[model samples]
Target: MKAWEIQESFGISHLVQVERPDPTPGPYEVVVKMTAMSLNYRDLMMVTGRYNPRQPLPLVPLSDGVGEVISVGAEVTQVQPGDRVAGCFFEHWTCGKPSREALKSSQGGPADGMLMTHKIIHENGVVHVPAYLSDEEAATLPCAAVTAWNALFTEGNLRPGETVLCLGTGGVSVFAAQLALAVGARPIVTSSSDEKLTKLQALGISAGDCINYRNTPDWEESVLSLTDGVGVDHILEVGGAGTLEKSLACVRFGGNIYQIGILAGVTKDMSVIPILRNRVRVQGIYVGDRQSFDAMNAGIAQTKIQPVIDRVFDFEEAPEAFTHIEAAAHVGKICIRV
Candidate 1:
């Protein structure tokens, strides 16, 4: 088997491809022949040593992948050999609320990830992919899509005809917009690039009037104007500290804010007055559990929601794919065909 491993706590440059022995499954585990994997901002942070202080060196660095089960261990019945399955980014949280133990069990961090020809995952962590989606599309589901589902449906409780706001055109935001539309909610997406906004509008995503945040600076005013002075029912806050205040300004009174990413930097300082006055509920979302992953797959199957894949790279070009994500050059999920 071939895999990319980080032998030191360095940047993406430290990722090296090497040959390794194929893994065998444990009593409750399954070995998957990886078909595809996707990139996320967290993958870059892991390589740069910016997230998860507990992450050890010599790690595999990806959380999203789809593969075919080639082997299964004893006592495994959830899935069988040759099933098309996608592993949860956080492998231990199968259902309900996440525990401290579940939080500690993550892929592409301290534990090995899916940047390999084969991966052995606990049987409990693997969920069957939607039959309608391709390997490239299913590869995008484990992290970005699941995070969006958790933000809008699980935590935000976003209802049909309600208005939702997404911060940018990145993978999570794009998935958030798509999920909102699937459930009949209106999506207001913001981006610094009007070109990308135009593309978003072409997708039948109403765009709810986009803001060129780079130009407007105080883009929340535009959001207010678009909502006719009422604010959005839910705001997917992916910019972290940089956009927290703006998110506070744009969410409706008694609305929910899903703070899910730190793309703009980690430390955040913002006023609590708006939260207090509006009675806003802010939930910090880690990528969701396996039950949510299964529910999301069902939703995708029902709605036939197509995941937006910006580009696909061959397995040998995995390093370049990581570089492209690091440079923020792609639109949606970037996948590696293994």
Candidate 2:
């Protein structure tokens, strides 16, 4: 089997194609023929050696993938041959409390990921993709969509008629905006590009009001203005350290802020006075567990929410897909056909 591997902990350029023996499933595992995989910001961090330092060398490089079951091992009955399935990002986190052990387990790290021609996944970690979605669409659900789902519903408890603020037009933000709308909550999406905002409007998203963050660096005030000085009910914070303060400013008193990503520089400092004054709850979100993933898939089936895919690359163009994401040029999911 051909898989993309990071030859060394250098950068994206270090990613190289390598041949590995095709894997056979253990008694509780199933082997899948990968159809598609999607990229996430963490993948970039892993490539650059900026994520967890414990990540092993020569690691397989993606956590989100969808495939069809080709063969099953002895005790595997969760899925059979020909069933479409997507592997969980946190392979060991089936449900309940996430411990350090579960957090350490993931595909595309010391554990093999699905960026190859075939992947073997433990039956417990594989979830059936929504019947309505194609392989390309289903591939985007594992990490990005699940993270958005956890951020909005699990952490924020966003309600209908409440206003939610999503920063940037990344995969998580886009999915969060759509989910908010599906639940009757209003979404305010910010972008550096006006053109993208127009496209979002065409998709029936009012966007509350679009702010060109590049133009107005203090866009938090704009969010305040839109909320009639009350601030938004929830904020999906993707910018991490760089945007945390502004996110605090834009959230309403007693509101929740889901901190999901750190696309900007990592280290940050903030005064606790604002959080104390507003009584805000800040929650850090991992991708989520199987139950949450299943709930998100159900919502996708019910609403038929289409993911915004910026581009698709051939299997051979996987490196280019990574490059596109690293450049921050894509508006939504960047997929690779395998």
Candidate 3:
């Protein structure tokens, strides 16, 4: 089997293609032949040494991909040889709360990930993709989609007619918007690019609901104005310390702020007074578990929500995929055909 690895260094330029022996399934294991893979911002950070500078070297770095089961151990019953599946972000996190042990099982960093021609996953770590989705679409589910799902449904407990503030046009944000629409909730999206904001209409965002952050630096005011000074009920806060202050200002009293990303620097001087004064709930969301993934798939199957793909790169152009994501020009998910 062939795979891409971060060989003895951390950068897109350091990624090298190499050959590895095909893996065979052990008891309760499944071997999948990867068909398509998707890029997450975390993947870019891991490669560039920003996510975890201490992460081990020579690692296959991606948590999202879809493949056909080519083999299964005798004890495996969850999936068969011909079933299409996507690997879980945390191989051992099947249900319930996360723990230190479960966190260690995360792929693409401490564990070897799904950036190869074939991968061996525990039978419990793979979930069947929705029948309606294409392989490329299914590949985008493991991380970003599940994170958005966990934030809105599992943590936020979002109700219909409530307003959701999506930080950007990234995968998780877009997924949240689609999910919000599916549940009869309203979503207001923000992007630095007006073109991207215009493109969001295809996903059901209205021209008035989209905010160009570049033009409106204090976009939190816009959010409050749109909601008639009550503020949004939920916020997908991806900008980390850089935007958390603004998020605090715009979220309604007792609203939920699901912190999922740190795209805009990890550290900054900020006050915690607003959090207490507003009685807001700030939760840190790390993807999700298999139970949540299953629930999300069920919802997707029902809603027939198609994942937005900005571009698809050939297997040989894997490095270019990283480059494209770093440029941040995409409004949706970026994929690679394996």
A best-first ranking of the candidates according to their TM-score comes to: 3, 1, 2
Q: Write the per-residue lDDT of candidate 1 for residues 225-331, one digit (tens) a residue.
A: 88998999999889988898988998899989988988777786668899999999999999999999999888889999888888999998887888888877566
Lowest-sum lDDT 10-residue window in model 3: 198-207
Two-way TM-score contest, 2 vs 3, winner: 3
lDDT of 3 by residue, 1-338 (tens): 99999999899999999999999999999999999999999999999999999998999999998999999999998899999999999999999988889888888888999899999999889999999999999999999999999999999898999999999899889999999999999999999999999889887887899999999999999999999999999999988989999999999999999988999878998889999999999999999999999999999999999999999999889999999999999988999998
Q: Candidate 3, clashing residue pairs?
A: none
| Residue lDDT tens for model 2, 81-145 | 99999999988899988988887678776576778989988898899988888788899889999
Using lDDT as the measure, the top candidate is 3
Residue pairs that clash (backbone atoms under 3 angstroms), model 2: none
Q: After superposition, how far is residue 76 of candidate 3 from its true place, in Å?
A: 0.9
Indicate the TM-score of model 3.
Answer: 0.99
Question: Backbone clash tally for model 3?
Answer: 0
Query: What's the TM-score of every candidate structure?
Result: 0.97, 0.97, 0.99
Q: Quote the lDDT for 233 in model 3.
A: 97
Candidate 2 vs candidate 3, lDDT winner:
3
The candidate that achieves the highest TM-score relative to the unseen native structure: 3
